[model samples]
Target: MNATIILVGTELLSGMTIDTNSIYMAEELNKYGIEIKYKFTVGDNIKDIVEVIEFGKDKSDLVILSGGLG
Candidate 1:
């Protein structure tokens, strides 16, 4: 299966926080024969987050969201 990972956090965008979630998830997903098609780091904006989700769903079989710690 194909998957997409979306990371939502201003801290991640700003580079203050290290993004380790995607790396870990990617490793785990690969074991199940899942491929991550797209990975995105979005800031704390509703409009942008929505846009990413909308676009991601069309191209990927699964969309996994992580790191939206507000």
Candidate 2:
């Protein structure tokens, strides 16, 4: 199955922080025979997040979003 990873945080896009979660998730998912086909980083903007989520959902069997759930 294909997966899409979206890291959502303004700090991430601003280069204030490096994203390690996606890398870890990708590696772990690969062990389960899941392929991550696309990765994206979006800021705190709702529109951009929504757009990426829609795209991820449409293109991948599973979509994983990390960071800023609250």
lDDT: which candidate is best? 2
Superposition TM-score, candidate 2 onto the true structure: 0.94
Candidate 2 per-residue C-alpha lDDT over 1-70 given as tens digits, one digit per residue, 9 for 90 to 100: 9999999999998888888899899999999999999999999999999999999999999999999633
The parts of candidate 2 lying over 4 Å away from their true place are: none
TM-scores, all candidates, are: 0.94, 0.94
Q: Give RMSD to native, each candidate.
A: 1.2, 1.9
lDDT of 1 by residue, 1-70 (tens): 9999999999998878899999999999999999999999998899999999998999999999997554
Clash number by candidate, in order: 0, 0
Q: Candidate 1 — what's its lDDT?
A: 0.92
